[model samples]
Target: MSRTVFCRKYQKEMEGLDFPPMPGAKGQDIFENVSRQAWEEWQNQQTMLINEKHLSLMDPNNRKYLQAQMERFFNNEPFDKAEGYVPPEK
Candidate 1:
């Protein structure tokens, strides 16, 4: 059976990640508090942000910006999105 966490983002108990999605204190915090579903949502958003903004992880500033956004995302705060992006409608 999978572990459950009180997801900070969804604000409810849900399935937790098998392991921390990353390293360090932030990753451990996320592993203990963020649900897998929320993490996946951030992954999608992160990918979009990277592509639209041409973010390079090699750049410290870019990585820092993404890290901040990730924190905001898990904390259920307003986070930046790719400007001018429109979801495809079916």
Candidate 2:
């Protein structure tokens, strides 16, 4: 059976990630607190931001910006979105 966590974003128990998404304390915290669904959603948003804003992960500043945005996303606070982005119709 999969583990369940009280997801920080969804605020209810849900399926948890099999492993930490990244290294270090933040990853551990997210593994403990964030649900798989929330993590996946964040990844989608992160991709959109990177593609739309032309953010390069190799740049330290860009990485920092993404980190801040990720924190805001998880906290349910206001976060930046890709300007003029429209989701593709299904």
Candidate 3:
């Protein structure tokens, strides 16, 4: 059976990630607290933000901005959305 966790974002028990998404304490915390679904959703949002805003990962400020957005996203706080973005029709 897969591991389960009290997902911080969903506020309920759910499937957990098999491994930390990154190294260090923060990654470990997320591994224990964040659900895999939440992480994947964040990845999609991050991509949209990066593309829409033309954010460069090489820039420390842009990275910081994404970090902050991630925190807010997990906390259920308001976060920046890519402007003028319309989801493709199925």
Candidate 4:
């Protein structure tokens, strides 16, 4: 066997070994559980924000303004000539 392997096999007898703790010495999934929960919460908040923005963009008054703008352009009116259409509830 290689000298390094032989020496490590009896490393406890050397009296100067400084090996780190074996895996799971403190607890398993300590950092992993915390990180996973944080990531899931972040994803939920992002999804909620995205859904709110989508709903606002799809609102009726916003759609009306878009339609009016398109109509004005199709009728050959200058874009600036269309009346400023404010959102109904805003």
| Model 3 Cα lDDT, one tens digit per residue, 2-89 | 9998988999998999999989998998999999899999999999999999999999999999999999999899999999989899
Q: Who wins the lDDT comparison?
A: 2
TM-scores of the candidates in the order shown: 0.93, 0.94, 0.94, 0.26
Candidate 4 residues lying further than 4 Å off, grouped into runs, are: 1-56, 80-90
Full ranking by lDDT: 2, 3, 1, 4
Clashes of 4: 0
* Pairwise TM-score winner, candidates 1 and 2: 2
Candidate 1 all-Cα RMSD:
1.1
What lDDT does candidate 2 reach at residue 21? Answer: 97
Task: Write out the backbone clash pairs for model 4.
Answer: none
The whole-model lDDT of each prediction reads 0.94, 0.95, 0.94, 0.35
lDDT of 1: 0.94
For model 3 the local lDDT of residue 35 reads 94
For model 4, residues 1-90, the per-residue Cα lDDT tens digits are 211111222222222212321256322222222233332433443444345444354678754654454334334454333234343595
Residue 32 lDDT in candidate 2: 99
Q: Evaluate model 4: give its TM-score.
A: 0.26
Which of 3 and 4 is the better model by TM-score?
3
Error of 3 at 86 (Å): 2.0
Clashing residue pairs, backbone N/CA/C < 3 A, model 3: none
